[model samples]
Target: MQSGLTRDRLIAILMLLPSIILVAIFVYGFIAWTGYTSLTDSNALQQLSGLPAQFIGLKNYNDLFTGGLNLRFRIDMVNTVFFTVMFILVCLAVGMGLAILLDQKIKGEAIFRTIFLFPMALSFVVTGVVWKWLFNPTSGFNVLPTILGLPAGQFRWFISEERWWPFAWQDVPLILSILFLGIAIFAALWYWSKRRSQTAALLAALALLLLAWITFGNPRSLSGLNPERPEAHGFNVALIAIVIAAGWQMSGYTMAMYLAGLRGISEELREAARVDGCNELGVYRHVVFPLLAPITLSAMIILGHISLKIFDLVYTMGGGDNLYIDMPGINMFFTTFRSNQFGQGAAIAMLMLIMVAIVIVPYLASQLRSETKL
Candidate 1:
């Protein structure tokens, strides 16, 4: 029986080998290759001549953050933060509002739900293109004012270079310290509740170290990473239009998730809340919202991931030449293709990967810990 079981396991392994090998070669292999490229001083000529790429260590990264030529990248980072915040906030608000309305079982509910969700069927590229024309200052939405006998509005939309909520690069360390310490604390709380003492202890230690560093250590040394030390980073006003388009495209997705979560909730629980003399708002505030926390978290994680790697919409909506509304994606494209700076391009790609990983890995770790019941 032991020999037979061994043979069965061997056969299963053999059967799965091809898929495992493919994923390793295509996915993991490419990531490794990209990392290597980022460390090299590769350029168009070097790549074409089949020359051995010169390893320049972190020079490419240094150039992006301190060499002063890639200020657009710094702006892209600012735009991303503001865009992500507004996009997620708007989508959550609108989605939850819609879900609550549909939960009322109003007339033509199916039709309304379908109408709201129809945008999800379209790609971001499509949404961007449509919104681009709609936001034309002289024609699309601008003409609406004329219909009311007002002069055509002069909002430049994505063409505008205006900014808001400005901050210096010198303040980055403070933000990073707070953000990382918050994550560490959150992880510790979760693992501790699971009774995973070792993991929880490690997380607590990490949190303590971060807190100590922030409270006592010289965090100022880590600041001033931006190349243009005095240049301001801010919420680029041009990104607001992009946020609206993104929110419209994704709000329905969140609405569906919330609707499913709401429906999954037992009506008896809601009735209990009412029986306890809880008003409609109180029922949602105390019972419904708490129960829907997981769904909200899941939606935020997914949406945040998308927002970080946003490329196609911004590319298609504003075209690649709009300097006022440039994003990391567009910057990477121009660097790699137009300027043929493979090293810098790869560095940008790696940074993008890091940003997404930061958002995803924590959530995945927590999910696995819960699943294992440890």
Candidate 2:
């Protein structure tokens, strides 16, 4: 009997071997090849024929960070940070709001849910095309305000070159002061919670003083690396339109996730909080929101990864020439296929992979450990 069982197990292993081998070769093998290509001076398209390539170590990465010729990469890096942060925050807030409303068991709940989720069914290409027409500066949706007897709107959506909240990159001292103030606020809260009111008050006072000095005492203008162009660029307002379109498409998915989380919470717990003198707002703020932490974290990770790798939507909507709305994915596509610069493109790809892994791997490890404990 033991020998028969051993033979059956061996047969099962043999049956699965092909699939395992295929995955290892196609998925991980290609990833290794890409990493290897990124370490070389492999710009020629003919290099795809397995010709000898020159290994240049980290020169490509260094060029991306500090090379004068790689200004587009640096600008795209800024755009990516702004786009991802705003996209994630807006999606989370909108999704949570919609989920909370739907959880109230309102009338026509199914109809409302369908209406909200319908956008998610459409592809990013479709979403981008529709938004592009809607945001056309001189035409499309811009004419609505004039039709309504309002002043003709001059907003240029994605084509606008203007930036807001402009500040020089050399203003690191001012930025640090603001960040210190934020830290002081959190420290004050911690101290107050520990019944150290005096210490909390002192911290708050110092933070205010530091903020005032940074704002009023400093008279010199902050500058960038190029001293000739002292005025630094700020957030591109053009991205607001893109964020709106993307958020409209993805908020429904987040709403569905948050709704599921809300439904999983026991009703009795909410009722108990209410009975304990918590109002509707208090219950949501204190009890319900805390319960939804896991859902929020999951949504953030999913949306963050999507934002980091976003390509089709921005490409279709903003086009390739708009530097204000450029992203790494678009840059990578142009660099590899359009410009025939495979080495730089592969470097960008590796950096994107590292960024995504940084955000997701830790969360996944923690989840696995929790499952193990359970």
Candidate 3:
């Protein structure tokens, strides 16, 4: 019996060995090697062996933060956070909304679904190039609007530095969409109540007054359109473009996942809600959303990860220049690589890894907890 047990244990270990080897080689091994490189002052073309690539402690890290503006270290960190947060939020909201809309028994559902998923099928490189052309001032979207008889010189809209507010045009719609949705749910409810009950006419009047007041309180100008300063124009444009394109591309996949989650939900729960006097909105809010939480959390994590590592889209859309403008995570890598600063480039990669981990760990913990309870 003892001999037989030993044989079984040995066989199990042998079977697991290859996966462990691969993880050590590709995962932990690369991470340790990169961490070592980050501590040294290595260059791209030729790593100076004679100079001793030994442990320099956090010297490289210190230099990165306080050494020179060439590093643009602080700026890069700020940009990474800013871009990641905004992109994740926008993608989640838009994707979920698309999922809900497609969930309805709409006509030509397959065609519409395919159109949405088409961008995700291609690599980000392809999507970026297409968007760049569509957004280009000279022969792109600017030309179309002007040719369509909107006005003179509106075609150069993307590049305009004056009152043209190029970035505003790009970023505003998404921001406004996000902002509007929060208000719209209540607005929709208010409208429904007013229509159903004549006694609630006064409440509808109050809601309209509130909406108009809020609208006027905020600036009418699109945030992306403002080119008050030269330094802001290019990066802003690139960031907005990338976010919109990515959000649109990934939305279909999110929708499909959500639809699957929705399908897995038994009809009996919804029927119970209906029997309990829950309306359509109430059923979705109380029953459907709670059951779908696990899938939604998964989608959120994927969206966040994609935003953090986004490269090809920005690369193709803005070329290598986007990094230089103000994108720290991207710009740092490009600049370091260009300057033959291999150590610094590795450090930048490490920084991005840390930031992404910060986001993902907490998110995953919450997801696991929720799932365990369910």
- Where is the poorest 10-residue window by lDDT in model 3? 156-165
Q: Which stretches of candidate 3 lie over 4 Å from their true place?
A: 1-9, 44-49, 152-237, 323-329, 362-374
TM-score of each: 0.88, 0.82, 0.70
RMSD of 3: 11.2
lDDT winner between 2 and 3, please give it.
2
Give a tens-digit lDDT track for model 2, residues 259-313: 9999999989999999999999999988999999999999999999999899999
lDDT by residue (209-292, candidate 3, tens digit) is: 556645564433333233353222223334555566777678778878887887777889999999999998999999999988
Choose the strongest candidate by TM-score. 1
The weakest ten consecutive residues by lDDT in model 1 span 220-229
Give lDDT for model 1.
0.88
The lDDT leader among the candidates is 1
Off by over 4 Å in 2: 1-16, 45-51, 167-233
List the global CA lDDT of all models: 0.88, 0.86, 0.66
Q: Where in model 1 is the C-alpha error above 4 Å? A: 1-8, 178-220, 224-229
Candidates ranked, most accurate by TM-score first: 1, 2, 3
Q: Candidate 3: what lDDT?
A: 0.66
Predicted structure 2, TM vs. truth:
0.82
Residue-level error in angstroms, candidate 3, position 292: 2.4
